[model samples]
Target: MTAPIPTVFIGGNHEASNYLRELHYGGWVAKNIYYLGASNIIWFGPLRIGGISGIYKSHDYLKGYYEHAPFQGSASRSIYHVRKYEIEKFKKVNSPIDIFTSHDWPEGIERYGNTEQLLRCKPFFRREIENQELGSLPNRTLLSHLKPNWWFSAHLHVGFDAEIQWHGEGSTPYPPADPSKLPSSVPTYPVQVEKNQDEIVLSDLEDNSTDDDSRLAKKPKIDAGGEITNHNEPGCNIPNKEIPVYPPPSTNFYGDSETTKFLALDKCITNRRFLEIIDIDTGSEETKPHTFYYDPEWLAITKCFSKYMSTAQGPDTIPSNIIDEKNPDELEKAKAWVKDNIKDYRILDNFAMTASGPPPKSCNPSTNLNRFNRPKFNDTYLYRNQQTTKYCQMLGIDDPFTAQCPENDTVSK
Candidate 1:
């Protein structure tokens, strides 16, 4: 019988932690499966100048700190710290690591096109891609040297229809590889020195060429020096009254008749459906009331609203109590009722169904009760401790969560 191939998936951040927990509980945790790194690994320090001075105090502290820490100061120091931490983690793992999976494109693989723009605009990213000197980072270079046959990553979101090869030299953009001609190699084992010899092949299953092509076609043409030029102007602007300001005769009608206004609404609604209900009297645009149709799949609106009524607003403005705290017996019954009826029991009270006035500006209107239940702001240190404890408990591993340090105990004495 063929031996199961060892796989190591590395994901850091909240989304990854949730996914890992689901995978573990869902019976997807295989004997060969290993989480190569911790979920909440980034190290953020205080804004104070000397805060980072005493940062690297211990191995565990330093590991957790730098994993999520910003890559500032000399590139060499940042690269060395990150690489050292990652390599140490890899070494500490007893499992035969073969695959390296991540939610991000390993350092240097982000330079295909518009990477800078994408990174700048992206939300919830722990570190800016620009601050990360991708080519200079040891992780990308060393990954090639260590030679994990497959590297699975997802943050880019766009699919790769054809297999792409990383040259391993630097940020070299190359054409996509033909999937039909791709070779299949035996899964590498720990002792397999030949593992690093093979080229890393990215799966084409996630390729989104149709969207890419459409985006590319829409990109306004630029001159050699990268300046946009108006193709319509002969040399410069030469106003001609005969020429219609708007193209397409169907939309450029000068007459202010009922038919013209109706045609205008039809044309505008085709692009912006929200323009369907323009207030003629107020000269304001409003969304049609009928546009807000009920979607049965929307759990927040369907489930929460059906069972619960909105509560009166308070001075401090906290969510009204969903369970009867004074009565423990009733609380248990309420919890049981929620668990049995609701699709996501953990999130029932989170949505704040009883809260009055408009929700917080940052809050998504579409967010369900379960999503709101989890606190948005996180206390990193406390979160890390809890995550570590939970991970150890779930895996039946030794508890790694530490309280007061040995030095603190000595100081107290």
Candidate 2:
């Protein structure tokens, strides 16, 4: 509440997952503080900020939001894992995104940067980086699909910068004369793939072999003074310390298809300051408004795909790929519904605490050493966060989590 500037965030493992579950559609967690929810897009004047919360796991990624409050077993931790059900709706995104953020780095992102330097810092990462098991596979797919101007992520404790060049179809690595001439339709990712532990095996592996990712790692050179120098990565001025960063122009697939600037920072400590401020020209400087806006398009997409939301803890696969929003008429109807149902597109600045703080550890007593029964965490009751309740009410939908419990009790998996 004491934050002087408007702060926004995405969730990682170290959080109260139950509270985040309540506001699945995203909401103000406290005054001037916003949680991006599971997946969403918001507008601040001309800037379209899109984000997804949580890390990715292959097995759980294909499942639903099965873990409920008063979480038990591995469910407590697994609930924080990323799910494909939430990301499927974004496949319907046809518009451009200005900026996007996630809690973890995109898979194979290390290949696009100073990987050699990274390996020198953390030798343990070499195996995963070599095996292509280091980052989020789904996010890498989204990176190509959305092609936002700027992407930010932090999970691996390091500071790095890289750019992704959106080479077009037919195996081309350059944009055409008129980028708008390029296709706006997103590519369909494999609906089901052979899953290995921490890996999604793609059929197109033969074509991806030439990415020369090792060369990208070799691009970074160290001078005698220990400053970082790039061999071939152009227009990127990666810093040893904080410097003014100017975000490249918003990516226009038909124009400059190679404009995504990816930046990931290390954990800040002692004398190192990782904070960077980029001067963005989001329309006009004279009328720089600071207010939260619900993106109508994102809302429409969410409404159309709400039925695909999963809450099963088992192997119940949600047929989310079957959703066909490509038909222009269907999406238009959803937008019309959003307009008619929601009178004000601007999010009201209301924040409320929906659950009590975690009980003090002193309240927990040690159980019998030989007792193997699951410990009861009945001290806290189920909380139906009203922000989500009211948001769903306006959208002419039920709160996916609370609605399942009906009486505001624990949601049955």
Candidate 3:
């Protein structure tokens, strides 16, 4: 049976690490469904979509490790957190975005709208919301950076909406100024200014290329005279040398700088109001006005994934360089290493079979685990504390969100 509307999703903190690893660049999950990866932007007709997976964890952001089977304790967290590399790419293409999605809510986003009504709706969050101690710090920072028209999120298991208003002067706060407003000027000498172009030049050291190790096995040898020579050539007696490659460019992490609106969905599996559909007007019309346009900055960001992203491959086999070597002992040793470290690759000929079967008619409230499954408060508090301290130190200020989440008598100490 065919469905009425197409569906798509972004990864949450509890994503299937192996599955996502299989589709790093976001392969199709079903006939018309797709998964948005760690960092990406795509176009559906005229609508431009951008998304970043996972929640924000300080440690996970630091170590953006690739997925491996026999998942470790931090495996889930590592796969789902917003990594420094992803954020760096966003900063590099610093421009306006259309629709953005993250797993967690932005920190202290309550003040952008009616917090009193939000508290009234969900009394259980009275303590956290009133204290301005909910949501994610990294998400808040990203929201300010990528000022999208509409933001969608999940993982907190409660559906809420608010308009995060950006103020004052900035490219993000308002739409691009009317080009017609500029004064006409006399023709001047033609000059060229360097425009930003998208490029991904990965170093050998940081290269996660599927065949990188194989290429390394056949790397040319350097002779004493500083000349690069092949060891396989006749009369060549120099031993093969291993060169230490340098790491990728260091990424700079910055804080939020603008306002944005957000709509966080509840637990889809166990909530009656699981789905929240947003209607966006793509045309420019009054009352039904739609200001969305083709964003080149966002287009540049998506290109990063298109040209250089990695592809999931089968089990590790000995490189052809090792197999084709003249020596027989080298082949045997390589086989032994593979036997000890590599497992038989699981055949996933039909990758779409991994998709969740289909949507249920309704979520049973009797089986809901909201009470027992609430996230820890102290953990959230500690994260906010760390973020606050870091921003304060960086900005040389006592408080970073003083203008946003101001101190009030009713606020928690």
Candidate 4:
């Protein structure tokens, strides 16, 4: 009986290298091992940096030392050229090469509408959209010539668990042009050809149907119990009142269009000393706002306004008049309301500050701020104060005011 054909998996880049290393170290001693891509050197270079010359040298070393022949190929090169090279390479070693591997989709797969998006040749808004189809490129001259029984490739990050038959003669649905008007490289060859003058039948495998939309539909559903489930379920009619009611639509202030406008406005603010209060918590900070350091309370209000400007601008912008000067109960209520509703503010003090500049020498909290000629409310100072307040709050210490020195007091050397 013929020995079971050895199988191996190969991929591209550093990820493949790490995977191969794990396989090698895990005692997987398969006689056939292949590395297909440009990044193999990234993995093997460190092992034999000065000692080895090329990939063949490393392969030979592995085979001689570890008793496993290593196959290497560059998928970037022409598939036809690589196939020919592989056949010749295997012939010299007198090894029967049964399988082919690559880090790229076969040519026909690239023709699938979805393949264009995989290569980022086009824009894709949602990840769920199938931008290309599978097995659409086998008709290409290079792939057709090589014609491996089972072609293995990745690069798309898609899974085609089921067998995909090649439909070479089918018309492509993209570019929305007539195929007849397209120029052919060469005359199509007849499928019938006698190798030893013995009649052999070649079946036409192309499925010529423009209705490929069905092939691109969502995959069959599987139930939570891991069994195949019917997707057609009867809809249950329930009272509309029983359904959860959603709140009225609210507008986003820092969305793409607004963000762009804000950036431009920030540039103007940077020119003037008018403060720009940024909500640092949301990772949205304007480098320049219209003045010097503004009050944190004002900054919080600005953030809230920016978040729901459309809604805020519509009549109910300001809250009902409520005063709590010395009333402890009202002050506590106001503090809670501010904390819950307001976004924390951060000031962009130095517009052109850099690490290499004459400021922020060390971020150590205990560093003497007086020695650096930095302002009392510099980023470091403010950050340190914030941290102290946070620590005190976490420790259930209600008096954060004691942790902070007078805000206006400058440190004197």
Q: Which candidate has the highest TM-score of all?
A: 2
Which regions in candidate 3 have their CA more than 4 angstroms from the true location?
1-4, 120-133, 167-259, 269-271, 284-413
Better of 3 and 4 by TM-score: 3
TM-score of each: 0.27, 0.72, 0.48, 0.20
Alpha-carbon RMSD, each predicted model: 25.7, 11.1, 29.1, 32.1
Report the C-alpha lDDT of model 4 over 106-153, residue by residue, as the tens digit.
Answer: 433433333332223112212323422222221122233333233344
Worst 10-residue lDDT window for candidate 3 reads: 237-246
Model 1, 217-281: lDDT tens digits are 34444544566543222222111101111211111112221110110111111222122222232
User: Could you tell me how far off, in angstroms, the CA of residue 296 lies in candidate 3 after the best superposition?
Assistant: 6.7
lDDT at 330 for candidate 2?
58
Scored by Cα lDDT, where does model 2 land? 0.65
Error of 1 at 366 (Å): 18
- Quantify all predictions' global Cα lDDT against the true fold: 0.26, 0.65, 0.45, 0.24
How far off is residue 16 in model 2, in Å? 1.4
Clashing residue pairs found in predicted model 3: 54-80
